[model samples]
Target chain A: MNRLFTSLAVIILLTQTWIALRLPKGFYQDSFLLPVLLIALLAAAYLMSRLTQLADRGKFWQRPCQLAVPALFGLMILLVWEAIVRGYDVPLVLMPEPSRVLVTLSNNLPLLWADFQQTYLKAVLAGYLMGCGLGFVTAKLVVRSPFLQKGLLPLGNFMASIPIIGIAPIMVMWFGFDWQSKAAVVVVMTFFPMLINTVAGLRSVDPLHADLMHTYAAGKGQIFFKNQLPQAMPFIFNALKLNSTLALIGAIVAEFFGTPIVGMGFRISAQVGRMNMDMVWATIFVAALAGSLSYGALALLERRVTFWHPSVRREH
Target chain B: MKPQLKSLTQTQGFAVLTLVLGILVIWYIAALLMNGNQMINMLERTGQSWTYTQVLQGAYSIQRPPLPVPHQVAMELYQSVLNQAVTSRRSLVYHSMITLESTLLGFALGSLLGILIAVGIVHNRTLDASLMPWVIASQTVPILAIAPIVVVVLGSMNLTGVLPKAMISMYLSFFPVVIGMVKGLRSSDKLHSELMMTYNASRQQFFWKLRWFSAQPYLFASLKIAISAALVGAIVAELPTGAQGGLGARLLSGSYYGQTVQIWAALVMSALLGWALITLVGMAERLVLRRRGLTR
Candidate 1:
């Protein structure tokens, strides 16, 4: 089975190489050819599977086959996307091919890097920290004062329901068309999630634990730190995880309103106006990379911090 | 226990009192700072301003920002609706209707597509393996980046009108529904499936009787999110096309003319529209869930 799988991979690569060689120079230059080639590749794969005597070792090949299917599907999509645009002679202004997008990224690396620094490094990071910190503090305050819990929770809900687009322009007006405005939007976007999650987390401590702490004559601060805070870590981390994505999105979209010619959102909107689809795609690629990495890092932190939680324990 | 209950009630009462007092104090201070005479004078001054910049600066100088004071906006809004010719030029109500037409159309199309894709994913293992990841990756390419390309491509095809804008909304709104519906459909427990199996139910019956019913809450939650997303998508769609009608167009024009009041009024209207849409869905959810005895 292993041998058969190896042969199949070899055949697929060789076929692709042969097809690449047979095509006219700059065949990939035309996006439409890519889709046609992809379809042919899929057909070849089907036929290869039929000819190969791999049926007896089906279970053995299942895991590799499972992995291969998604990879092939992704490759096929890119191929078709490449082909259709090329063959149809679709204007580059409409949809640039993935290869062209890559070229644009490399060619304009410095500008992209600068936009990244302005938006992600300044606005997103600053706003995320402040919002999450304030939310945490407020949650603690509200826990201590039932009056606050009653007054604030509904207000937060109302605030959360206000769409980012609605407040973003207003924020731009208030904070000016700079990173400050974007950060303000991010702060608004991140605050509610953190507040709600932290409140829930603090409340998540078992009454029995609280009772024990009370019996031990622990002070309010001691009880909170020793019992409630530890219990709420998982929920707090969940909010943080959510806020990471929200902050990135908030920063990017906020830049769309009125920005000073730099930032991911500015580049995206500006480039689209210039009919530079490739650069728009490139900016998106960087944004996606940043969002995913931040999310992944937060997830890692959650795992580390909440290692004592049952959910983490079960995974191990 | 009585003391505990009394304390709880007092605390709640205190909280409510504080909130009310806070609001009253803010309002009172604001009113005192911008006395009625000053407000009238500012309004009178703003009315005399001709250039866009002057009007904007006048509006900005006011305590509450007079660009579009409540009454001015109300008058404009009334005029837009009543004076149909206003829409032909750049009326907010007229553009809102144009945008709404596209938003509703896009939302319907996107919801249908999401359900179909979800159904395919739920039923077919190969498709589930191959398509789900790509669907996720598709969102990685931001809609803002993609909207213009879609507009240009569709425009070149001579497909002008609300459909192109609606298509953009669909692209933006469908992902959430697909993800939500997929999660909802899979929420049926093993015991429930086994019970259906014991009843000799076919695959279709099993799905209809169990999975579909279980997915309603998730579908509703997703619909709330999707509908707002559709509105946003419709607005963003207008940005690229430079379309002359819709709320997006109104916003764009408002920005160009420095009609800060007009922009604020339009924004408030959109927010109200969003709230209304969400509320409508929530009402439907309540009615449906109530019928099913699922409301807690």
Candidate 2:
């Protein structure tokens, strides 16, 4: 059944693509093939569902099958998008085709690379490190005092909920229109989340474990290192993962306020004004890749650091 | 009297007041130091020697200082919010209302879409496998990077003002809801499912009676996050579009011509707006949970 479904899906996909490509101009107004295309699309979806069902049964193929399922789904979405845009003659400004976006990305690799380096390498990296370091240290210091904790925790929670990105303009004014200002914005954006999470993580140590350590006559330092710090790893990693995306966003948005030249946000806003939707998309592609890569990297690190975490450890 | 004083000292409100006061004092000092440099420069350009007290006063009251003092910002905020009519372009109330409109609209739409998607994912194995990964992946993209494109694209299509901005908000606010709702819907116990099976409950019955109730806390938590994200989205959407009637536009215009006081006022307004929105969500959560007798 699975084999039959796969072959049927592939055939339907090929036939639909061929027919779509062969459709003449003005075919959208009145085309008998439209019903055929719709039927084929539904059939393709049904067959794909069957294939996914089989994928769940076979342990050996599960990983690759799970991966392929989403990839195939993404492909179908792109195919449909292309068809709709072409069939209805949607303007390029409104929505550029995935193919055109790819072409633009490939064509402007050098430019995109420069923007990536400027935004991601300099601003995001510097700001993430500094902001997270400050937050962790502050949390450590504040955690020692109940008074400070009571004061800072509520403040931090309030500040975190507010749009810290609004500080982009103020940072630009203070630090000037360079990568430094963007970095400043990122620092402010990332700091509170890290502080709040680190505090919560440190406070999450099991009281039973603490008592156990106390019975062992553990010193404050020993108790913290052996109990609290290790227990906080997952929450710290959560902050790290959250900050990874936030740092990118802060840098990009800050660039909107002011930047020298050649940054992801600059390219996006500039190309957007010129109605170069493809270039804007290509820039977005780069930003998305960078953001996901950082997030994925942090996630991998989290699994390694918190391997004992129930969420990390699999049944196997 | 002794007990009352001790209780007051131990209260969260007291802690907050202490911290806010501490922040204000620090802010004033920092403002003096920062703005003093410009004051000194101006004094030198005028070729006049200045006393420390005179420079202190000048720094505290200078228009367009690098950092405005708290009082200056407060005054500006007060004037903009209360002095002007709500319909006036200069009123912070008007700008905030515009932003709030988009934020709420997008939030509602996003919550509906997220709930629908969550329900679909829970019911259909194919959608669960295929769509869940993309939902997670969508968040990693720098959403602000696309704000300009979305604004312009929608603008070209004759969809301007709040709609384009709201679309961006919906894009942002939906992710947290989808993740939270999916988790909530799947959180029912195996024993509960077994009980439902013994009773021969239909899928819809299982969902409405068991799954939906189980998901309430998660939905409220995600809603809090979503509303704030929606506000951020509305603000950023305003930035790209250069719209004249939103808090984002206020920030941009303030930035353009060196109106530090205006920028600070707008920032404070947005923070207040976010706080109010989150409080409203909290209230709703409380009301809903209490009505259902689920609150502990």
Candidate 3:
């Protein structure tokens, strides 16, 4: 039955794509055909969903199905998106098709790479390191004093709630119109989350384990290193993963305020003004790729560093 | 007197006050140092000899200082919020209202949509398998990067003002709520489910009487997150259009003209607004929980 649903989904998807391609240009625009096409798209989505459900029934196809379900879902959506825009003859400025975006992406590789370097390598990397490092240090300092923790925790939570990115202009004014300002914004944006997470993590050490370490005549440093730090690993990595995305966003949005000629945010805003939707989308594609890649890399590192942790161990 | 002083030191409010005072002192010194360089340069360019006290005095009031002193910022904030007419473009209150309108509207829509989607996902196996992954993946994309396109596209369709900005806010604020609500709705345990089954409870009855009540804490927690996300989204949306009626525009105009005080004032206002919004959500949570008899 699962195999049957899988074949049925594939058949529908292929048929839809082929029919969409074979149709005359703008055939569905302002016609009854548009509704029919939409219904077909819905049908395709429904079939794909059914196939996913069937695949979840057994372990026989678990690995392949796990990868296939999302891939097929994404492909179906993209195909329908392409068909709709082309069929409707939508203006390129309003929404460019995926094929056009890919073409523009390939053509603008040098420009995109420079933007990536300016935004990611120069600003995001420096700021992420400094911010996370400072946060960890602050958390460490706060962890030892109950009075300080009580005061700082609420303060840190409040700072986290503030729209920290609103400081981008002030940062630009202070640091000048370059990657440095962007880096400053990223630092501020990423700092409080890291501090809050690390504080929580460090305080999460098991009392029993701490007492055992005390029984063995363990010093403060020794207890922290052997027991508390290991317990804090998962929380630290959680903050790291969250900061990766936040750092990228901070750098990009800061660029929107003021920047040198190159950066992902600059490209996006600049292209939009020119009514160049494809270039805008291409930059977005790079950003999405960078974001997902960094997130994936951190997840891998977390699994490696916290292998003894239950969440990671449970998969085995 | 000694006992009173000792008791004051033990309180959390006292600690926070001490920390904030410490921060202010550091900020003052840092501001003096940063602004002093440019102040000395200007004085030197004019060939006027300056003393340390003179430079320190100048640093606190220097226009467009590299770092505006806290008092300077507070003064600007005070003037902008009170001195100007509330409807005037120069008024921070006007800009804040424009931004707040969208933030509140988008937050409402996003929460509704998110709750609906969570309900659908919980009841359907296929949606759980396919849509859940996409929902998570959607956040991994820098959705803010598309703010410009959304604004421009919607503008072309003659949808202007609050709706476009609100849509961006909705996109962002929905994610946390969906994730939270799905986890909340599924949080019912074996004993409860067995009891519901014994009662021959319908799906709606099980959901309303059991799952809904159980999900309250998670929903409120996520609501706090969602409101803040909505505020950020509204501000970012204002950026791309370079719109004239929001706090984002105030920041942009300040940057353009080198008005550091204005930028700082806007920043402070937005921070206050965020605190207020979160506090409101927290209050609502308390009220709801108390009504449900879950809290005393």
Candidate 4:
């Protein structure tokens, strides 16, 4: 305990000194001391992480500690990036610093918002719901029929193998240059995962459970709604989590083909062409935030829905 | 040595035939439905009233239907795959080969890098703490969004062809391997770890003998995923290059010319290539795992 506090004090002191006492004439001038300070900070982070991992394993109050480690790591990375770009005078066309990307993101908020709305709020969500819904229904329909199983299940297995690049162009042509085409591509991309997952989940019911239900004279509907759906929740959520990312990917890639001149994908490709690399990075930052948030949201929902699942129970 | 043909029961054969016929019928119906507007436009242009038979006949065999009929795509595919030499630039096979060149190279490099990173993460606590979150964060930035940036920036450096495309593939292919490997290397239970400790095995020895062995199934599964991802990455990489010899470029050109049939042909080609590559990986996985008597 004493050692931990002492180490923490030293870290805080070093960081405070590094921030408070700065001596640099030109912002672009190379600073040897910056790398030295960063190295010291990195070592402190390493020690801090080791101590936390040893002492704290998911204690609720240590949440701040858990957050701090990654935040520090990210901060150090950004600083290094800023340093290299400034010191070496890397061209804007090649790579923009993190600060530049943030500035661009903040300045072009309306544009980013419009692009986000077009891609995520419209195409991605609609396609995700439709694709997963249709796939779930299809899985339900095929569950009892061996014929359907043999037919569609193999097709589902082949689904991931279909490159979206090929599908996107065709989808754009078929559905026209709008969100509908992108949604169609997302639908195509997401359909198979839901189908495969739901089918597997439905079929995964233990024969003993079926026998028990049979002894109770339960109908198929009762057996499914009462016994199977709960079990299938985890698989269903797995498909949802997988599809969330894919939906974003599908919509964005579909936009690259031909769009209404306002979408994440369209902006990215267009901005790159115009040599506005900061905007491109800004759009990418939007995409990253969107993708991660969607993924994280699905995961949280999965945890709630699949609380009974062994995988969930095993975590605690 | 082989499963007998008799294993494929009559019902299975019937189901297969039924599915093919069913898909064909659906394709024909879809073609009719999609071409309705076009057929009406054609008739209006020439001032001819639509006869049901005339429209139906034309719908199934249009020059450029939105969704090409199955037979039309099949015929187009046949011409490109069989009539055109594999060496010909027009051939889907030729484009597929070009894509595969980058895909394979990228998969190799990515797999190597992934394994090295996984090894580092597994052995070093500092790296595990620092790098793991960033690794996860990396994938959240959709590859499609960044692919254009990567291609253009790399292209500006006067780098061309397979290497640049391979880097895109590497960008995608490495993620799954790292995730899988991290999970796999840690999958050895407490009992096994204790057993290794009792034998006084070094870290290297334990990894090779136990952790690596335990990770076989995961490694193979991740390899399949990685290769498939690499194929997608390779295709996407072709997009910014413009008329470059890859399946993606072919699809782009076909789309530009409104060659729906040609686009469908390329789609089939990419689908088939991805399927074949995945199947080969799966076969290798099965063969290796089976040799070790671990089927399930």
Off by over 4 Å in 4: A1-41, A44-48, A54-60, A141-143, A200-238, A304-316, B1-13, B115-130, B155-159, B180-215, B291-296
- The TM-score obtained for chain B by all candidates, in the order given, is 0.76, 0.91, 0.90, 0.90
Compose the digit string of candidate 3's lDDT tens values, residues B175-282: 878867886786665578778999999999989999888778769867877898899888878876668889878877777888888888888888788878988998
Q: What is the lDDT, from 0 to 100, of the residue A145 in candidate 4? A: 87
RMSD of 3: 3.8
**Model 2 per-residue lDDT tens digits across residues B200-274:** 999999999999988887698678778988998898888767787899889888888889999889898988888
Scored on chain A only, each candidate's TM-score is 0.80, 0.90, 0.88, 0.86
Q: Provide TM-scores for the models.
A: 0.73, 0.88, 0.87, 0.85
**Residue runs of model 1 more than 4 Å from their true location after superposition:** A1-38, A41-70, A128-163, A190-247, A293-316, B1-90, B194-202
lDDT (Cα, tens digit) per residue for candidate 2, span A66-104: 778778777778777667766776778888877789999
| Candidate 1 lDDT tens digits, A68-99 | 66676766666556655554556776777777
Model 4 docking category: acceptable
Order by DockQ, highest first: 2, 3, 4, 1
- What is candidate 3's TM-score against the reference? 0.87
lDDT of 4 by residue, B1-296 (tens): 23564355435666667787888888778778889778989898999888888888888777878888878889999999999998999888899999999999999999999999999988876566667666756776778667666776778788777888899899888987887687677766667777899999999999998989877876886787789889988988887766369998887888888888898888888888888898899899999999788664
Per-residue error for A195 in candidate 2, Å, reads 3.6
lDDT score, candidate 2, position B249: 89
Interface RMSD of each: 5.2, 2.5, 2.9, 3.0
Which candidate gets the maximum lDDT versus the true structure?
2
Can you tell me which runs of candidate 3 are displaced by over 4 Å? Answer: A1-8, A22-24, A30-32, A200-238, A299-316, B47-49, B119-125, B140-144, B181-218, B286-296
Give the Å error, residue B175, model 3: 2.3
